[model samples]
Target chain A: MNDTIGITALVPPELMYACGKRPLDVNNVVPVSSSSPSNKLCAWTAIWRDMILNGGLDIDSLVVVAGGDCHNALVDGQKAELSGMPTHYFFYPFDGDTDYLRSQLEKLVRFLGGIQDERMFSLISDLKAKGRALDELRVNDRARGSDVFSALISFSDLAGNPDIFGKTLDSVPRTDIRYSSRVALIGVPPIYPDFHETAEGFGLHVVYDELPYEFLRLGGSSLDSLASSYRDYSFAGPLKNRVRLIQDELLRRRVDGVIHYTQYACHHTLEDEIFRQHLDYPILTVQGDLPRPSTEQLKLRLEAFAEMLGVMS
Target chain B: MNIGLDVGSTTAKIVHVEEREVIFSKVVPSHHWTELIDDGQDDRCIVSTGYFRKKVPHCAAITEITAASLGARYHNPETQVIIDIGGQDTKVIDLRSNTFVINDKCSAGTGAFLELAAHYFDIPVGSLGRLHSLATKGAQLNNTCGVFAISEMISQLVSGYSMEEVIYGLHQAFALKISQMVPSADTVMLIGGTVRNTGIIDAINNVLDSKIEVPGAPQLVNALGAALYRERLDDGR
Candidate 1:
């Protein structure tokens, strides 16, 4: 079998070349598969559970990048293990220093069955190539001060495919999208593909934030990691980190506004609510789910809020 | 006017029933039941309910929240379940025939959680729900207990999640917590102060995966139901 087993939410392209494993994103598999067994849980929970139950979740190892509060993935992993499956949880802490990320990758490699010397070399080369490509694209899209609203759309499209992310970055017109105000996309990373695009269409520039990619990184101070290790629940670290991430985004961005998207019943939106009030600029709150105040209602509310900001400005 | 006065821990509500129809209603603070007596609006048969049932001045009779709950259901015989999430406590009433059984022993996952969160945020409790419309993204809270929720809210604040998200999360957590209390039967109705918070309603709908009836002026349904009960009794006696 040429395919080494791995599970991912959104596939990071380097994983395929570096590890020689087929990156299986469970979300993609579940839509095409059967989910009758997951009726006991809520609709959202059922979607992920069906992914696991149908063997779409078969992975020799799991690498969860930080973002999108992957509670669905982790919960499904627990259920899978109970039903007999091999899995591991990895944190991509937000610190961004590659050393800790590399070590964490090393541990994952060993756990998955040792990174061969040749494979390690290939992996580094793969990361370098991907990094270079990303940098070039980022530079060309350097119309940074230009309307960054489209960059958000490009970012939203980037969720599922790195190649598409690369391509979408290339396609965003360098037209002068006059710099409006800068805002932060706060709360439970956008796992959904069109989230950024939807927000960007509303004439706001969103810097990526409080996402799994940003919060789930494994490079935080060892003190926090050590603290998490002593905790009884697997979700404790992620939960605590989420609060920290939102705070950091608020401080770092000098953000003019915040757009909070939280899943209903997540209990995390409480933090964002408090944060929204303290911000000097306007804040737009969006509660996401399949039902209730429908998308149209949310859009109207957001538009009205943006108009209110326009009036005040 | 046949009036049913419900003296709650925080608010006093009175419904004026004339010939089986409620003509007017007043909600005042529990401390101001004397204000109703001071108005010189007497000669009306009074039925009282709520935590401070004994406090209603010139009341002809008093009943518990459970009795009022049952009375409300009796008025609307079609009501299968009654949910009351108030300031200090939460009630999940299972209405069967004419009897209503209440879950009043626990205050951990009720509207007290909201009050605790509001105090922690130091905002007027009435103003909490208005912030949901302003949120674009929200942070989540993880408080399962009412008393300890204050500490959890504080931790979330220190950690940097916005107060709106914390409040929304508290409601979401509550909906999830209360969902298990819902009977398998349908037509569940929500009552009490928490019903005024749409965020909680959305959260509950998310958990129940179905729409529950929330009448207009939902907070007054219990008092209205009490008034209807007095109307029936006065005609019979």
Candidate 2:
């Protein structure tokens, strides 16, 4: 149940790209791609597609994770209404206080009615344990070094069995690269495979992946407290404060530069420029569906940026 | 002597530079680069760029975006921004500092779009300038994609739109798509083979609200940049 929300809510924007919509809309983040009936889809989108393909849309109730500035709530709500499913909306507030979380949680409890009694707490504990275990295993995997793309796949979800995270970690080869400059890759999850490898090949070790390897477990002792932490997820904040968590990580991890990825025709690409203005480190802003100009062209640009940053001579 | 080959999607370009001066250049269909190079071509320092750079051997390969930027700067030192429309892609680069932005995944504001419009109207691409010269400022074309724009062109023609006027709209429509990419720019340098279309240069200037000066040989600019880069690497500047 927890993984269900995470997978749907943390939609890797590649699905948006595949839809052939200019400036990806959360509304078109539909379970099916009507615009492009046949574009290669990654695992995250594959799961979303398979769910719709296998009749996951036919449901008694719909939970809309209403997030983002536009279309997110309205689209999800419209989808539920269109399908004739009795619907509930969980608004991920862009800015919040503890009172906000408490009030929302209370309203949710009222909506669920008897869910507050006991089963909810047990479910929360199990989810908390499982999420933490996944994060721990993921951290261990990164420390030992796994293939960047494969690592992101393991981090996609708990893989239905959270215990497999450790076994999956052990299965991949580890590469411990001592580096000249450590960088953090931020923004929409990487949809391009060559980008990570290209960055590493150019001599910059991607020490931190802010969005892709995101294991967002809001820590707390109890379910009610957990709601407060969950509400504080940086993405739910105003644009200025949105990447506060990412900024903190950059400082803590000693990151030197940032490679910010974005897509064209995406209303969300606005976040890319905003992050550029916010970060103090040298940031290389890359936009579009694939390497701009061309793949080797983008690599040269990366190498030049890395060289400029003294990451490579 | 140094040779730079740009194997683009729609065409192949080669430029010969001697001591940083471009002495020779040519543009041909992409398939002919191999045959051109293999038979009677002076072997010199070789650098390549664009989509097909890997298919032919070269001393180094660079992305067209970066090459285009360096190319634009080489043509005009004051070039602060670059708008390059190629066979299949369009790019906007801000060179006041390092920045690269391209149209999402769609090939709407590219050379391919105009090629479709030219074929649809049965107007020689080279004669578009003459057609635009005769046209009064025309109707706005909302669809910029190749397929839909062709359909839109047919509708305009059937709806009794003037042939020259509709051709002008195609240029303006391509310009409009370019405007949306960066939204606005100061001192934007327009390059790529499509820049030879004088109507596009005029429409883009109107859309950007700034006059854009085209390089002497616009198609040769990217290949020239790669050639100069080889000189820079050898000379260590």
Candidate 3:
């Protein structure tokens, strides 16, 4: 029997599985969710918060990634805790202090009733390796970007079960991808549900999804290794480090352009200027306010971006 | 001859190009967009752009941003940035980086904002430029929001500012709102029908440090771009 644990942001799925718990990423449901949260700054946190409070999400306990990643979750997570949901606060060290992250992982393990199955670590490590292969398929144009993005974004919680998630990864259709330009999507994921598909419609092949790639990139066989790997989680640490990581990925991926998707009022929206200055690529910065189908306004930007990269280049 | 059709939020424009030169161009209300193409033209020879780019007859449809880029570059090969102030939205395209920002969420910096002010004054929107020239000193209207700025405009009217001065202030406010989206550039090309308003050009000049240049028949740039794109396709460039 596994307890379903809800996570507001990237909490180690391996640790949750090791603790005989299933980690469910709450933000995963947000893009497809129809929840219209009143009195909200960032819709991502607010919608998930409202869903947890309104009994929309089924979870035995909640873990809020408070220290690094999503500042709004700090307050929203407490709101859920105040409403009688058993919750734990997990922090990622902003300075990449492995010792501090190791301590935080220990606290998280205790919150999850301690690791009950140690073999779960290797299972997740293998799954992440598969995720990396799926990512490579798209980068090499052997797989459609939209199909690959749908699978890659789910790496956060591996769709709640590693075995089921592995099958899901296996089920992703492998087909040759054709596009006008290969682009990397940075910043937080777009709130629009059909964003990748829409980009594909406009002849832009999304080679990299930033945050989702982070999930597949960082993993380990044990708590000590996990601490070292996850501590360097780019979003958790300094901007310079994240920028350097993104630059390397962009180069490795050979992306023709970069699209930075910022959610309305998300703190990450502030990083757009820094990325534009540092990335040295043609960067298209787009913003989304609410979770809905991709708008004509967004499509215009994507189409224009494709044209700029394709026709102009 | 190649035809370029641009049907936007407020108006539809068409341009006829022959031998890389625009021979004729016309603008009409968006709903009457058919009038621009009613001269028995082949659909295969036409390229369409803007809001109704896909909804209209065309051989190839492109976004306004792309159209503006191609059009501005055709006019001035050294064009760095393009500030296209249309009826409903304003787009700032930087040709150097191939990046652009569109202000559609707010009406403050758009042509609709100016139209709202003109409606409040009970005057024709075209007369705003002439009226703006008459003001000696403009009043201050600081609100960035189009709705809130109207209230501020009324307050200025009540505070002894003349109608022309209030219009000047409104233009200044609009310029300030749009200036935020325009990146630092050596030369900025102003396009779209809204550039016909000299008041806006003056106000934008006052607010931005960059040298502003408006092409002849600024409104037809998108239409011309659409036509030019057709030529590009024919030449396979």
Write down the C-alpha DockQ for each prediction: 0.02, 0.13, 0.77
Candidate 2, residue A122: how far the Cα is off, in Å:
14
Local error of candidate 2 at A245, Å?
3.5
Cα lDDT tens digits, model 3, A1-313, are 6889999889888888988999899999999988789989999999999999999899888999999888999999999999999999999999999999999999999899988899999998999999999999999999998899899888888898789999999999998877889999999988998999999998899999999999999988788999999999999899999999999999999999999999888889899899988999999989998999999899889999999898877
Local accuracy of candidate 3 as per-residue lDDT tens digits, B1-237: 888899999999999889889999998999999988786745456889999999988889988988999899999999999999999999999999888899999999999999999999999999999999999989999847999999999999999999999999999999999999999999999999999999999999999999899999999999999988886787785
TM-score to native of every candidate shown = 0.42, 0.74, 0.99
Alpha carbon deviation, residue A287, candidate 3 (Å) = 0.6
Q: What tens digits encode model 2's per-residue C-alpha lDDT throughout A112-167?
A: 43232343334334444544444334233343222544444433333434345446
lDDT of 2 by residue, B63-117 (tens): 6765786678778888777888887888777665455566635656888777777
Highest lDDT model number: 3
Q: Pick out the ten consecutive residues of candidate 3 chain B with the lowest summed lDDT.
A: B36-45
**Taking chain A of candidate 3, what TM-score results?**
0.99
User: What does the i-RMS of model 3 come to?
Assistant: 1.0
Cα lDDT listed for each candidate: 0.53, 0.61, 0.92
Q: Give lDDT tens digits, candidate 1, residues B27-121.
A: 87778877754667566667776766655653444344444454456446677777777776665655542222233434556766677667777
lDDT of 1 by residue, A1-313 (tens): 4344445443232334344454555544332333444343323445655556565555555554333335555666666667666666665444443455456555665655543334433333333344334333322334332233333322311333444544554564544343345566666543344555455555555544444322122111232332232221122344454555555656655555666766655556566546544544455656654322235435434443443333223
